[model samples]
Target: MDAATSGTEDKTPHRFHRSLSGLGVIILTLSVLSPGVSIFVSGASILQQAGTGSVIAFLIGAVVCYCQTALIAELGAAYPTAGYDYAAIGHAMGDWAGATTYIATLINMPVFLNLSAIGIAIYLAPFGIPLSATMITFITIATVTALAMLNIRANEMLTGIFMLIEFAALLLVAAIGVWHAQPDAAVCVLNPVHLDNGVWIAASIGIIGIAVNNSSWALAGASQALMFSEDMKRPETIGRIILIAFLLTVFFEIAPVFGTIVGAHDLKAVLANDAPFETFLGQYLPAFLLKLVSLSIAIAIFNACLAGFVGLGRTVFSMGRTELFTAPINHALTRLTRRTDAPWVALLLLGTSTALATYIPLTAKLLLLSGSTTILTIFYVLGVYIGRRSGRTGARYRTPLFPLIPLLGVGIVIGEAVVLWLDAETGRKSLFICAGAYLLAFCYYRFVLMRRPGGWKMRGPDDIDALVARDVVDA
Candidate 1:
């Protein structure tokens, strides 16, 4: 296409047309969440920690997710940019915090692709697929990257289809688990406690973090959909779409988990197993159905790589647009092809991170270098708390509970991090590393990156507290 044909560049820097519908948003949210994998893996983590009462824990986590997304919706409205995580934080918290949070939170996105790809490998293992997990990951990355880079319409269509497959997979597990469940299973799972005792109570409290992690992991998909705010037809409706997505998360994830609890009727056994759903289902389900369900699980997870790249690519491109990195790389990362307006370079950069997913242990993937995100998100909670009413107002959406809600969000998230540290082995091992990462990223941003002309001009120090209070309201 020639210059005349291409028309003017989108002044919004790496813009995506608001072509994604409300339904597309829901699919994107669910797809990125990879509920198939989360349910099987994270559900077990919750069962191990909280047992049958895990449903309550998931509800609590959902409330937290609601508050976080409330703030996220406002931020998306204010910025209306791709990679809104950093963009909103940068605008709300300031340049330095934004830059650091952007780098720190990078780990969370990859796990979507990583875990989903991991699901693919695990599901196909029974068939003796010659491809190694690493090879499969690379192929997934390449394919998804190609589709994402192809066109927005194609990407949405593919994701929407894969999302339904995931739903079917979850349904298969939930239906089977519920149908074969013991008579007392329903009453037992709803019981207030699985093993009422001080030890169990303490364990449950600590496990709330894990439950919340799974809940958050599922909801995180909903939260991440804001990265494409520029692509949504109605920005305000993002909140509503997210709410619906949460309901789906509860149904697909919590229902199956509850069914597993009922079917197994062994709290200790569920807790000890990493994939209780798989274990119980395997016992009752015939080999053919089991293999079919396994394939569904893999396809569901495989969908995440596509959604993950879209999110991760946009985040990097957003940073690139601001010249967060050095010029040569930054220019490339932010560059857009005329044919598709896709961030080809950014997609390639994101593809590089797939290597870690194949090699790292799940605990390491979940905990190691993960603390940085919690720390930065605290800044986000605090940012929205203050940033909401900081300047001009008269907006379409604002989360109620105001200071109290955001304050509670900060406290709970911080509490989760601390609890993870004191209680979970994964938290203990990676605590210092996560903390050290925040320190390192901050130092680099302050002393190295910010000192450069590109970073200095784009995100000057004085602009940190500058208000983005437009379209935000008192209610």
Candidate 2:
């Protein structure tokens, strides 16, 4: 055991070595955000729904995402643990709320992994990769799971390398648009028109609002940085890292999206193609370069899956350290490999689950709701409120403007939930299904978990002062 666990009585304590630099953490965060794939997917969806007005929608989504940063930064700084959102909420609110939210979030991890892994076939087909989707998914799961089992720093360097290629793809897209600067390109942002029944017409505010809400998916992953809090070489810098990651994610995702919008030679033709970004690039670039960009998309998807696997493994490891589950499960989860100090058991379990889930054909709406900002953002807002009310905001970093940032986040997400409820076809059904899942989770927490011995106790870095007093390492 390291010096951090020397005095603590708990045996087999699951600990993370503070070996990840702030830049490494940022790279991992961006990898999880996956600007390249998000541009191809969420960006294309926004273009289809709002057309040129997608630029405005992206800006609004960025603003909405920014509002939650304060809550994240503040809580992250206070409880710099791998448990992430659960740790912060557990400390601020209570054990039941934290564990329930953790359960809900954990159940959704495979949905994202399957979607990202399944998407590899879409991008790689252009590169003449002959593998079927099932084969590709299995290969991706095995490869990323192996990489995730490496020491955190090794994974960091690998992800950084992949991130460079990802950014290059985005930069190429932005450069093409700037080079092909259209005279009426400004109208795409200002006037915002969509082709309606073969005629160009101004987009309505409601259409733009829907686009903005959808764009939230494109910009949502920066907060994944909080999952690496305990691994940071300097945890105090986490707030700054999260803020920088958020801003950079907004820029990188928006640049290529806007570039594709303004740089298109024929807006109608580009929008009509299902793969809008690839179609736009095909018009300008040589075949080899187009294929190279397509290859970058595949790499980006793999990088995202790898980074997400690492985060999810650490999250489970944290829960195990806290002894939130049965003793046997906790013992298994906390078993880090001696050589790498990596959570191999947890990583393997989640990896196998994701690999199995790839065979279960799920609807697009279900996947979308799984990653929705509505419920998770509600926990963040509550964490902030409870933190402030209980005077638990004594971290190195604090949210500016008191509660304004979190409250705004709450308002925006609740509005998003309302939008989901009203849209019967696309979102309402998913909301109803997600509500059932959430209700079941709550019941599990209240009826089952609370009745267990010691009752869902969570151990984390909630009080730096106490750690200092006891001369125990916080990270």
Candidate 3:
């Protein structure tokens, strides 16, 4: 029997093709740039309120994201599954935990897609596009649909082109800032300010949350790259790719913050204004070039939208294939055209959900909440704990300082959850929403889906190795 028809055999085939060595660099760059734009734009306001200490906040958050990335990287190298967090959590924890995390991921897809769509619409408004909410939704849906229909290689090429545009735009801004640098400005923005202890702590926590929200987007897709591991000439190379991408992202994420803090003395003014970077460009650069830059940034919003859609599609496709949802969804996802091997059903679902999310109010809040939910549910801490408990016998990439690093990850996540709980603005309602969604999914799974005769079984170490080997053979 064909693998697809044989219940004992894995049906998901690895048909990925190798591309650029710098694929991780490109993906990371795009991931960082896309979210970095929104963060700089929105985060300026928070930085203003928090003062120069915002830099410290960002540094702390970046470190946390790196820790999370490190844990996932190890997991990804070992499993090399498209299922990513769903697979990792399932393998490390249990089916229930994996199912819960999967549901959070599902919710996150729409939240991010909607936020990207809104961001694109807002960015374009300055160009006299007059894009309404409805138009934005339509454009987002249509564009994503068309792109999703393309082959995987085509998608990568399109993403690479968009990343180039984004990189150039960011480079231009950095150049302008450097040329306009004031000698008297501070070397860094983390200057200490006198404030009451309670107020200072509260402000710092809030700012850290914002930074985490921004930087986490880049780190979010680290596992997604593993989905393409079969295509890599050396699957182990994904580890290096992830490390390089994240380090580069660190530099890119921090550089502009330093420039913005130095250039704009009035953080409040910078924050309150829409498109602070564009405004900075207008004041410091030539008028015509400023317009061009603004257009580029607007186009960047679309780039982010498209990239988000692609990631979301792959994530859902992976989950469906693993039988976390329904067998029909998996069947649909695996029904790729022989020529391109792109699943149209998964793509259509991604586009439809993204378009729908655009209409939701408080999209930015939804996005942040969604990210937090995923991080919490997936529990990088739990993964590390499990790995250490399993002993280092079969580890492909063992994290240095084993127990400590993993323990630290768990502590940080727990600490962040506690802080969020205390900060009412960020807590209560969002947690409730996430909880309610998971509970509903669990009910459905327990009552209906689990009764299915055939589904993918959650695998142990030997089983996972077998699965990976099978995929390699199929490829």
Best by lDDT: 2
Sorting all predicted structures by lDDT, with the top scorer first, yields 2, 1, 3
How far residue 421's Cα lies from its native spot in candidate 1, in Å, is: 2.0
- The candidate 3 region of ten consecutive residues with least summed lDDT is 192-201
**Candidate 3 lDDT, tens digit per residue, 253-275?**
56665566566544344544555
Candidate 3 global TM-score: 0.83
Clashing pairs in 3: none
Best by TM-score: 2
Put down candidate 1 lDDT per residue, 172-285, tens digits, no spaces. 767777787888776665563544442344434555556675566455556676666556777656656665776777677767776676666445555556666767777677
Which portions of model 1 show Cα errors greater than 4 Å?
Answer: 1-12, 107-112, 192-214, 264-274, 356-364, 392-394, 453-475
Q: Enumerate residue pairs that collide in model 1.
A: 48-271, 395-471
Model 3: per-residue Cα lDDT at residue 218: 39
Name the candidate, 1 or 3, with the larger TM-score value. Answer: 1
Ranking by TM-score: 2, 1, 3
Give the TM-scores of the predictions, in the order they appear. Answer: 0.85, 0.93, 0.83
